[model samples]
Target: MRIFRFSLLTLCLLLSSIISFTLYAANDWYRPPVAVSWYWQLNGTVNENHDVDLYNIDLFDSSAELIQRLQASDKKVICYFSAGSYEDWRPDADQFAEKDMGKTLSGWDNERWLDIRSTMVHQVLLRRLDLAVEKGCSGVALGEVDSYRTNTGFYFRQDDQLRFNHIMAEEAHQRGLAIGLVINADQVRELVDYFDFALNEQCFEYSQCSSYGAFIKNEKPVLNAEYRRIYVDDKEERNSMCQNALTLQFSSILLSKKLDGSLYKPCR
Candidate 1:
């Protein structure tokens, strides 16, 4: 009888462990819902007055107090930072090595493609993620994860980008913060499960919005922005786009190409 009781107790403990692990695996991150309203302003002082479900703002430029204030207003904050590129104007710009720098981005002359495989670059990104945690951000928006598809000067293939992106996602999750994929639609299939949500630009304008449908299928949010002038200036065109965006189940917004806090037109 003693041996039988001991075995039963051990089985009960094992079952409890399994249940705990499953719960952790299932909800280890904050997954944004489809069609959730969000304000995207990464270029200037964030206007926290927008009544939305989420706010994607600059990680470095925005202060810890601002994040707390947004949280106080019942908003989830997604801190934005360029994880896959090296910006010359950032406060930690001097920490990057010359060898780690690559070709300039097509339109943004001040920003350059980063060697994502570099340990030095990874260290810098880790520090940035730590900063997001320190500031009490709910999630992080990692920009430029698709530099492999650009003229980045580095010969980064799909695997390289995937490994680097996984590292970023893992680091964010480790700190109990969610992470979003930014405009890397090509790798959506491989990365959908890794990232909590997506931050896309011009997917509709480029006819690539369908590529992000996988997120909707999996019950994840695809926060999108269309910078086309017609969508911003013409009410008819904007309504038409919003109609399609609703059908696609995307959280769409209209903004200027500059991404300043000035222009904001939600599709809902």
Candidate 2:
């Protein structure tokens, strides 16, 4: 029998290369470590020079070429879409029956909560996933996923929400895409296992930062957005918030509530 051998240094280098290659191959999905900076812009022309690791952009608005550009620069892209809401402005809006829509989202005129359990809604969302695939999105950030927590004019048991969320995760994974839950802190524990990341809004301001502790503990990135006017101008307040976020190991930013690319502040 022939024996094959490698020196200690050669073996270490080989193992390091294997680990790097595994991570490189898994670029189809995002699994960010603690404190990864990311950018979220749902409106206006995407400002692609943020020096961030990830870009969450509107799935319908971002062109495939833009996504390819970001990936070419070694950045991951997470396509944004309402998984549990109906947006009348979307290209596929006409596909949703009026029955599938619930009350208008309080602040947004064009958005309405969706009947998450409806079969038609599922089909529409499946098509959205297909769009994400065609755009070469590394993953997706599913908005309004915790619809059961709101008065959406549709009855939803907690288990119904869980089932819906699980299916979203399963489907995205099956398509080789990672999935994130947005502002759905209530089910962090329940979904931490299924979701690749969590996108939170004002969790620190609401004293809800601790809700995503499980995500940090799991080594999954928690992208928190703080819209406080203070964060945009007051250095002391902004520093304090950043300190708290850093302590929590969260990747946080201060932005306009519009998410219109009007403001951008990342907690280092």
Deviation of model 1 at 81, angstroms: 0.7
> lDDT tens string, model 1, 1-268?
4554458889999999888766664577677888999999888778889999999999999999999999999999999999888888899999999999999988889999999999999999999988998999999999889888887998988899999999999888877789999999899999998998988999889999988989999999999999999887799999999999999889999987788887899999
C-alpha lDDT (0 to 100) for residue 91 of candidate 2: 96
The sequence of per-residue lDDT tens digits that candidate 2 reaches over residues 1-268 is 9999989999999999888756654554657677888999999999988999999999999999999999999999999998998888899999999998999999888999999999999999999998999999999999889889899999999999999999999788777788888988889999999999999999988999999999988989999999989888799999999998998899999999888998998887
Native-vs-model 2 lDDT? 0.91
Candidate 2 residues lying further than 4 Å off, grouped into runs, are 1-28
Worst 10 residues of 2 by lDDT: 21-30
Which 10 residues in a row give candidate 1 its minimum summed lDDT?
1-10
Q: Look at candidate 2 and give me any clashing residue pairs.
A: none
